[model samples]
Structure formats: structure tokens, C-alpha cells
Target: MKDKIILKVETAGTRVDAYLASCLKEYSRGYFQRLIDMGHVLVNSQKTASSCRLKEGDEIEIIIVNKENKIKPENIPLEIVYEDKDIIVVNKRPGLVVHPACGHPEGTLVNALAGHFKGKFVPYLVHRLDKDTSGVMVVAKNEKVKASLVKQFQNRTISKEYIAAVGGNVSENEGRIEAPLGRSHQDRRKIVVGPLAKKMAITEFKVLSRHSGYTVVAAHPITGRTHQIRSHFAFIGHPVLGDETYGGPLKIGEKSFERQFLHAHKLSFTHPSKAKKVEFSAKLPKDMAWLSKKH
Candidate 1:
């Protein structure tokens, strides 16, 4: 089905992509850019590039070409942290995929949310966490709220904190890793730093405790990138414990570990409905907690 929307710009000078992202909170900037690229979005009845700046009172028409629904809702359980009419914050457990993809076609958090919501409202992912990385995640119930949260993330106004146990002891009590990241030519699934890196990535960490040969630390990623924290730590020679993809140790101090020791402990963002700052957090899972005790 196609949904056509026409609006007259009241403010000038905003990029078309930015304007669309702001107005359509449910879709992402990337989605909007894709639309523009496909000539689904037009300014004054003429197709325009996503980077084109808008002029006041310019008429914009957007043709939303929605994809056919393919994902099926499942009866999977969810650990909801916070919920409102606009958004839902969930404490995602390890081993659960955030969304359905190639290998995982069902039983994802999206499936759980779809079942939980029961089609009363649409569930849109604001961000994501790795399958093995347990943490707090927020989902938007409506497009407006989703757009607002997306802008916050793009502006770096949202704050997030993670906890990870790295192999070997870290020398610095607190440090920052500012490096560019890019996909490895050698391994398509892995990421690399330095000249091999093609995108800017930054991560900061403060050591929490040091174990026999491991260190637990709080990590803050200034930029959201695929495997940023894991790759950054690995680049620094302290790969996350149990992260097999990044050369992390599978066993730490006689304990058999199964997954990456990375957890999203805290997330803070401005509420779209309430227009106020809100923060959410989740405790470490059993394995990470046990690891801390051993350390």
C-alpha cells in the first residue's frame, strides 16, 4: 500500500532528509534518504536530493512505499523495564536476537513485542544490541516518538553506559579509544581499526575491578557502530571475555564462559511524549554477576 503525504514547509533551510526524519519519527534518516534516492520524495512536485535545503512554504510530497509484512509475532517472553503509550524499555537477556534476520527468522524481541502489543500499535526499534550482549533497549510505539529518539541519538544527546569483562588486566584506570572503524577485508563479519577503519568510532572506559587475568570496566561509546566496544577493546589488546569473534578468551580464571561479557547497564534519553529526560538501567545477568564475584 502507498501512503501519500503532502505538507507545506513552515521553516526554511532544513535539509530534506532532516525534515522528513523529524516529521516522520517512525522512520529513520537512512530510510528517508533511501526514499529520496528512489524518487519517492519530491519538493514542489520535482524530485530533490536528500541534501537539498527546504524553503519556507515549499510543498513536499512523500510517497511511503511500505514493505510487505514478513515477520511473525511469537509468544516469547519479554522483560519490560518501562512502558508508556509512546515507548517501551526492555531488559533484554542474553541469547535473544533483537530482531529477525537471515539466520534468525523468528523468536526475536520484535516478535515478542508484536505479540505483547497485540497489534494495537506498531513497534519500532530505536536501537539495537548484539545477541550475546544483554542490556536495556527502548522501542517506540509510534513514529513520532521514534523520530525524536533517533534525532537524539544522531545528535549524541542520548547517554548510554555498558559493562564488559576484558581479557587481561588493563593498565589505565580510565582511558578513551578514539579510532576509525571499518569492515575487515580479510573477515567480512569482523571490524578493524587504524588505516583499515573507514568510519569514526570512539569509546571510553573506566576500570571497575581487576581479576587474576581479567578486568571489568564501564564502557561508554560516543558513537554507535557495529561492534565498536568489542573491536575497540580488541584493538587495545584487551578483547572482551568470551567474545570469540574478537579474539576474546573463552575461559577466564577456571570458569567456562559462553558469550561476550558485554552488558548495556544504563541508557538515558529525553522522553518524546513527556519532553523530559529519562534514564533506564538493567542489572548484570547471572553470568556477569558471577564473574564479578570471582574477580
Candidate 2:
């Protein structure tokens, strides 16, 4: 039988993960974060977030369950664009988590694909887009396709493009952000740019169009890293609209718009079989289209 522990918070505003770390001092914060991700930790009798703030007198429940996490295939819907015997391309929607990780193990795109393919779907993540970042991505059905796609990405030959609504009208029509990114020593959750950071990170952007006071820009990432676009833009003092993590400030975004106005616009890759270029595209989502054209 498993054991359960209950804790009461004496103060408010301590994050759920922080509180749990205090009670279970034996576990590392990263482990506590993993516990929060696996749904083992609950707040107020409901499944809440690791970042969730606790109020005084709030009750927290913890069950010492096994440390294994398995991805359960759930029957969920998916927006598939193109497919061959070797690979499948999906028009991933915003808020749709791509794979099972962190707090999202089930109800992910993988789960949906697993259900759609009826256990036949093999999920080979060629690349990743953030949970909130909507875009087009390809999944390989076999190892051969996976290896080819992975090589293309590693060689920086895959042609990928994105459109984003930023907080303000940028002065330059085009520019590149070259910075080294690595895990922040202070806050482990975020990536930091410094000379001590890892490999050269680069992003190229061109103003595509403007609307309703927000600038729609095309971003071509020469390198892929966690939150690269969001972080790089924010580093330049213009964060993407609606991305609170790296977003500068509320007033800054409100001055132009709301919502992370980013979209995966286009992708192109070389097919292993035909040795030809295959291209895919997704239209601008409704949130970015709510406003009329300005530029």
C-alpha cells in the first residue's frame, strides 16, 4: 500500500512546487517539479499547476506513487496535412501539446495520432515546437525516415519559416539575432544568453506585414533551442504578443495587441525517396486574423 501526506500552507503566494519542496525536503526541486508534472501532487483536492500560487490555509495532498510514467494512447482528434508511407505531417493547433513530457503526458498530439493510427503510428519527433506555439511538423513512421529527417535538421538544411505578431513595429525590416543559449544558472527553468553558453544560436526575421498596430514578421531560426524566438525577441526589447514567459510587459503588448501572435507558416524538406523538396504550410490562426490589415 502507498502512503499519503497532507500539508497546510501557513502563508500565501508560495508556489505549489515550492511548498511541496518544503514539506518533502528529501526530494530535490527538480524531482518535486517532476512530481507536479506527473499529477502526483495536488492542490486543494484538484489537479493544479506547479506554478500555481497557494493561499493560506490551502490543503495539499501528496501520494507516494511509483516514479514511472507511461504514455497512454488516447483517442483524440488531429489535423493531418500530408502523409506518405514513411512520414506524416500535422497542422498542430495552439494549446495542443506535441508529445508527452512535463505536465502533459496524455491528450497530446502523439496520443491523438496513436489513436488515429490505431497503435500503428510510430512517433519519431524530428523536431519540437512549444506547447503554445502552433505550427506544422512531420512525424516519421519508420526508422529510415526518422534518420533522414533528423540529419536534415541537424545539418540546418530544413527550410522552416514562421510568422509572429510582435509587441511593436520594428524599425529594421530585417535582422538577425546571434546569441549563445544555455540553461540559466540562476533560474533553471529559463535559458540564458552569454559567452559561456552553448553553441551559436541565430534567428533571421523579415517584416512580412502589419495589422492593427502589430507587426507580422517572418522568423527563420538558424538554430533551434528552447524558447529561442520568444527569448531572442524579448532580449531585443520586443517580445512576441501573448507570450508572457519572455514577454516584456503588459503595457508593451497592450500597446500593440494581445495573444502570442506567432504561427508556423511554412516548412520544406528533402524527401529521402524521390530526392525532391516537399513543402507544407499552415494559414494564420484566427487570433492573428482578428484585426484588419495595416501593412
Candidate 3:
């Protein structure tokens, strides 16, 4: 997919990178410089440098390519939830990585999808879930669908719901956590709620049931951030059960669980091909279901 942005210069003698950075605050100046260097940014239909000064009435066009490096296909099994010509929804299991990264090179969901649709369209992941978090995920089969789904996510038009077993009994029936999230200053790997947060993260939760020492809550994250739900719950002193990273209880009613008791229970978005809203859901995995019943 190609993204084109046209900007007409209103003031003269401003550097190209400076003007673009002022116009597009979501992107960094370094990103605009790279785009200018790559000939993606053009002035008056001609390629220009980042340091080039802009003049009045000058037309600037920026073209960005949305593409990912080709990945290898692996023969891993997939729990498909829904599929069509343009998109495929999967019930991603815990311990499954969404894509290939530095440490996780194989055995990923993308690899499995690639193998499943060999000789057909390569799957493009629209969003991601943590490796330890099992959930419903959607993949785009084509570039147009990928662009549409990505835009919907950015616009916050998609609704994501999760079911989690939290430690201790929550007193409130429903509540909202509106906090800014950023990397922890002390622990680089963990996120913290602080004034230095660059982005705002909000989570709305309702208690589903209260057990002997745990509470099951349905969470809806308004803004998707890294470990947003886990961190927010931890901040409220109700870490998810079995999530060691956030001080979640290791066992529920004397039964030990291996991973976090969080599941992406539901996902709603506009269908790119059908042009209608559709919602997909994944039932709780065996371990979580067992804990929920036993408690």
C-alpha cells in the first residue's frame, strides 16, 4: 500500500524537514529526513533534500510504502476462527509469537499462516498480542485490507475485549483506569504510570465474578499500549492471576497455572471487503476455563 500526503507551502525559507515535522507531529524529524533521502518526498514533482528550503506555493508530495520483508513459512498448526478472501481471524494460543523477531525466528503465527496458505497470498498481521497472552487476532491477506484494518486501529474504531482472572477480590463492580503509560525509569523492561508518559492509555473493566481470592474481570482497552492491561491492573494492586511479571498470583484456589489468565475474548471491526462491522470471539482456553469453574 502507498500513502500519499500533499502539502502546499504557505511560508517561504523553511527547511523541508522542519516544515514536515511541524505539519506531521506523529512522525519524527528523523523519519522525514529518511523519507526525503529515499526520494519519497518530492517538491514540485522533483526529488529534494531534507535541508532544502521551501518557498511559497511550492507543492510537496510524500509517498510512503507500507510493506514488510518476506518471511519464511513454517508448518505449525493454526486454530482458525474466521477467514475470507481478504482476511483471516485466528484464535492465537499462548506461547505463540505473532511475528518473527530477533530471538523468535520460527514457530510464529505468521509462519503458520504462510504455510497454511502456501502458493496463495501471504498474511499481513494487523495487530499483535503478547506471546504469553492467548487471544483473537486478525490477519490481512492483501495490502488494501491491511491498510484499512491498520487505519481502523489507529483511529480507535476497533473494539477489543479481554477476560482476565485477577488476584484478590475486586470490590468495585465496574471502573475505569485513565492513566498515562511509559517505560519505567527504574526497570527498562517494565511500563509505569507517571507524568513522563508520552502516550495516554485507558482501560475500562467490569467485574464478572468474585471467587474466594480472585476476581474475573472483562477489560476493554481504549488505547492499545504495550502491556497496558497488565500494567494497569498491577497498578491497582490486582495483577492478573499467574502473571509473574506484574506480581499476579501463581495459583488459583491451590491449582497452579503456567501462564497469565488473560484471554482476548472479543474483537470488533469493520470488514474491509464486506464493508460491514463484524465481531469475532475466542472461548477461554482449557487452563483458564478450569480455574474459572473451580474457583
Point out the worst 10-residue segment of candidate 2 by lDDT.
248-257
Provide the lowest-lDDT 10-residue window in model 1: 1-10
Candidate 2, residue 290: lDDT: 51
Task: Tell me which of candidates 2 and 3 scores higher on lDDT.
Answer: 3
Top-scoring candidate (lDDT):
1
How well does candidate 2 match the true structure in TM-score terms? 0.71
Candidate 2 local distance difference test against the native: 0.73
CA shift of 101, model 2, Å: 2.2
Q: What is the C-alpha RMSD of each candidate to the true structure, in Å?
A: 9.4, 10.2, 9.6
Residue pairs with clashing backbones, model 1? 25-143, 25-147, 26-143
List, residue by residue over 174-209, the lDDT tens digit for candidate 2.
Answer: 999999887666765566676689867899999877
Any residue pairs clashing in model 2, and if so which? 241-259, 241-260, 242-259, 242-260
Write the residue-wise lDDT of candidate 1 on 110-157 in tens digits.
889888988676677778888899989999987789889989999999
Taken over the whole model, the C-alpha lDDT of each candidate is: 0.85, 0.73, 0.84
